[model samples]
Target chain A: MRLKHLLASVAMSATVLAATGAKAVEIEYWQYVFETRVKAMDQLIQKFQAANPDIKVKQTTFPYADYQTKVAASIMAGQGPDVVQLFYGWTDNFISGKMIQPLRASAFPAADIERDFFPIVSAMKRGNDYYGLPTAVRSLALFYNKKIFKDAGLDPANPPKTLDEFVAAAEKTAKRDGGGNLTQAGVTMDMTGQDHQWWREVLIRQNGGQPYTDNDSKVAYNDEAGLKALTFYIDLQKTKKVGQVGFMDEGQAAFRGGLAAMTIDGTFRLGSFNTIKAFEWGVTELPANAKGERSNYASYFANAITTKAQGEKLAAAEKFLAYISSPEAMKVWLEVVGELPARRAAALTPENLANPIYGPFLKGLEYAHTTEFKDEMAQRQVAIDMVNRVLIGGETPKDSLAKAATAEQAILDRAAKR
Target chain B: MSATGTEAAAGGLWSRLSLSQKQVLWAWAFLAVPVLFYTVIRFWPTVQAFYLSATDWNVMRPASYVGFENYRRLWSDPLFWQVFRNTFAYLLLGTPISLLLSFVVAYYLDRVRFMHSFIRALYFLPFLTTAAAMAWVWRWFYQPVPIGVINDILATFGLPQQPFLRSTTQALPAVLAPAIWAGLGFQIIIFLAGLRAIPSTYYEAARIDGLSEGAILRKITIPLLKPTLVFLVVFSSIGFLRIFDQVYNINSNDPGGPLNSTKPLVLMIYQTAFSSYEMGYAAAQTVVLFLILLVISLVQLRIMRDR
Candidate 1:
């Protein structure tokens, strides 16, 4: 009787062990903390888990300032996210550093990706294999305060369409105190922000200067067109006296606070701007050059499978990536995060194209150039310093432009060598 | 039986040692944990850093030997030289100015009996506040016309508004102001303690000698406060040399910006390591910083001690 009882108990324990063995595969996901992005990702994770009950995903976040450092350190220590979110510009660094692995062709086919996603999404493609995929993309546009335009005696419905019109409107809208101090900025001028992108890809190209040449391996913005582009930017503050660099400390702050008349910003700013109840704003395409040529800068953050993902974890990560990159997921992301969807079908719908707020940004995508940055921050800093030298140091635009081109070329050369 | 036998054997060994020898053993046994900890935690990493400084490591790939290429590159890098100058400026300007201001405050506060601790606490309040928070507050204070307090005051007085953090020339000093202020409390407290330690008799003797207040301060009080002065100069010098948080938080949009005007050695090291992910180059920078700190501290000690 005792032997029989023991045998039954042993069988019960084996069944319990087997049950535990077949439990869900848990994988970790990491992203820099942006409120709407985090919320959208959380909602998607739930939807993904409900559909694929055999997999569980744990999401983690760090502040944007420390995100790169945290990822580099944690992944190097052999413990970190199975799947990670990285800026599209950092794809090369991530690929070369072995922080992320290429997607399996069977899981994510290059042909399918090329067909469905925006052509700019090709930035993530390294040779034949794709390193990652973006759920959304961003493009720059002119965000103007309708009330400010009316206050300055300009038509609210008619924002600037050309570079000359932009300057004229800015000069009219600009207000100054009795002592010559600027009371109201005609437009925001912050080089450390999106202005760097505006100057490099938009203004330079509009003026017939290619920011980079030879497949983005060399700087090519040191010519007369580049000088003209830079001079025009500096003249807004120096000759025109329509704006100041450090008026309200930041361009976005000044715009949101209603201290500035206009700002050039990206699509990612839409959600935050929508929350401001103080003013009614309008979005317009970036001002074109004399020949009616227009340009813009497009950028995005993409989700990638980290090198840490292997075997079961790798399968789980790929599934999560696929789910996040789906059309349905793009819809949810657009509703939550206010960034344009990466897939052409998801982004270019009738309702979306008709949206005045998102329409300008989408229109910008048609002529946008995605700069293949080897080091985004360093290159951005060079542009910032170039403008500051002209603005603060009283250096001529010609000298500053040459200096910037040299500095950026050195950065690219260093990265290439590495 | 074996356990008891082992215990008995250990006891026999312990009993055979002299009293001093037993005490020495006990002391070593007590020190064993910390020494082991330091070896693994501190010394090992420092030694590893030296090794890494000689190699090309970007954290992801396996490190390969690169001789002194990183060091050679750093030597030629103009940013390195500018950063070096900025660091020394922080040390020279920040150390002396803060020490003087703190000394004056502490010297006067020592004689005031009413609300003394409260006044000291008011000064100490800033020290307790986080560097990031203080930097943000100061940043707001330095803003233009309608937003910034300083500029607001200037506008009211009809004085031209100064661009504090924006101008490359003014930015370093603007960043330094809050750093000096934050450290004032601790330095004041130390000075006060040092002043008190000089004893009431010294002041009384100076008074009896018919020395003026200034004379008393110059001849007696300062001389007696020499040791305290030495400690503070060294302490604050090190503090200024390693300054990072103030400069970083002040102009966060461009942390050593407006043309890298206020970038310090530590900030440069952090950027090289984290932003650029050039571990080997960062390690070389780190070694340079370590040597600078070591040499400065040694020179200060030697000068202060000899005098």
Candidate 2:
């Protein structure tokens, strides 16, 4: 009887061992390192792992500066991550290189994804195939210092709504020393950072012009509308004397340090700006042009599956991607990272839409335009040259823009061949 | 019989060789490892780069022969010319100014007996520090009024705050300052060593002859310090010619910016290769840089030689 009991126990233990031997499939995901984003991703992965116990995710984050190099190198070495997050601008390069593969229709229904995500997510698609999907989208908004407005004798609550009011407010807020140099900037007109994005997406569209045309194969910003947009920008320095290029340490530093009154920045800065204690700040929709038509630039960070991933690995990656798009995951991402959710349903919810800080950025997304940039760096360089020629070189806006258009067209032509 | 035959052959081979031939054989035996290493690690890549420069390879795409297309494009490109001028400016200005400043400091500091090692260590501290850290610290020093130490000093003296790194005219000099400063320690240490190597008897003879301080420095001291000067000049010229870290860090916001005034050839090559993924074009630029470095070094060595 004792021998029989021992045999039965042994059989039961063997069954338990056999059950545990069925291993979980693991997939690697890569993202550029940002503290809040990394944390949110980790939390999302935890939720994913708990739900899908048979699937495991291995997450790695690289520094933003070297992220592209690392990803490209790894992909070329045939050791790429199963899932990778890329800037929307880089979609073409990765797609053309075959570093990333398009989502299969059966696995990821194109109709469903388009219905679930923001319209801008379609930028990741080439024809009928979708290359990637975004968890959040960022839109540009006007961030103004309340204290600066109050000191300038303007009402703190009433942010500028139109171009005329913007210039008027900027004039009041601008402070200069005895030497006629800016001590405190009224608004950041410098193209050191997002100024080019502002020029291309906001000003060009506002002035009834398109930045690019012919499926982004040609430059369209050399016309009267382009001239008008550039003149308006240059006039801020030459005519209004509100902001200058070298004023207050360049880019968003002046705004962050409370040395600049206003800056047109993105929703991604909300987390960083929240750390500022020196001044009270508020966000408003981007000011409309004289025609009363408003435009803002929206961009996103998208997650894609690499070409190296196939069969079970691809399936596991798709599962993770799906998890990232789910309302629950996006909610966590928005709360933790301060990015507006990419999904319409998620972003339109009462909690997110009702939040005073996030409301303006979300509202801007309704009419925001995201460019499917062919050569983002080259295009940006052309814009920089245009701004510099007009601002620093004392050239006419029309002449500078014509030169920029020629240069930009050459780049676009080269990209078209590629 | 087989063992005996093998021993006999080995002995015959050794005995037949001349002394010089044996010496050469032993020399080659010792040199073999380093020669193989250079061939694989250095020479091989350099040769491959020459081939790559003539092709269109963007890492992902299969490389196709493009003849001199990349080079041809580079010649017509205005940005390349601007970068070329910027690079040469760094070499011409950085080498001489840094050498003069370092020599002046080393010459004076050599005579001081109080806290000698400590002072030397202080000068050498920057050499020991990483270039990235030094660049960032200097970048802070070049900031506007409240943030920058240099501007704060200017303000203290009731001077107008200057946009050191922001101005196109000033940004290059601002970037070069830290680079020169970082290299001072190594140059000073080398200079001190050279000074110490000169026998005290020459200075004593000069003193007895009633030679003035400037005359002795101009004559005996400087004449004796030629080798050290030559080495430092060549090394520092190479350092300045390949300048990237300081410029990259200082103008981090828009690197080589404020109208690309601070751009060096290496930074341009880096951006082209990595940012644009134009490997073939980048390789062409690399070849140009290499040729420049080689020709300059040869010219420098020829000029500074003890003929």
lDDT leader: 1
TM-score of each prediction: 0.93, 0.89
Rate residue A140 of model 1 by lDDT.
97
Tell me each candidate's RMSD, in Å, in order: 4.2, 6.6
Among these predictions, the greatest TM-score belongs to 1
| DockQ of each model vs. true complex | 0.45, 0.22
lDDT, candidate 1, A349-403, per-residue tens: 9998999998899888878888999888788889889998888898989999999
Off by more than 4 A, model 2? A1-23, B1-40, B114-119, B144-163
Q: List the residue pairs that clash in candidate 1.
A: none
Interface RMSD of 2: 10.4
Candidate 2 pairs with clashing backbones:
none
For every model in order, the fraction of real contacts preserved is 0.57, 0.21
Model 1 lDDT tens row, B250-289:
9998998878999999999998887778899999999999
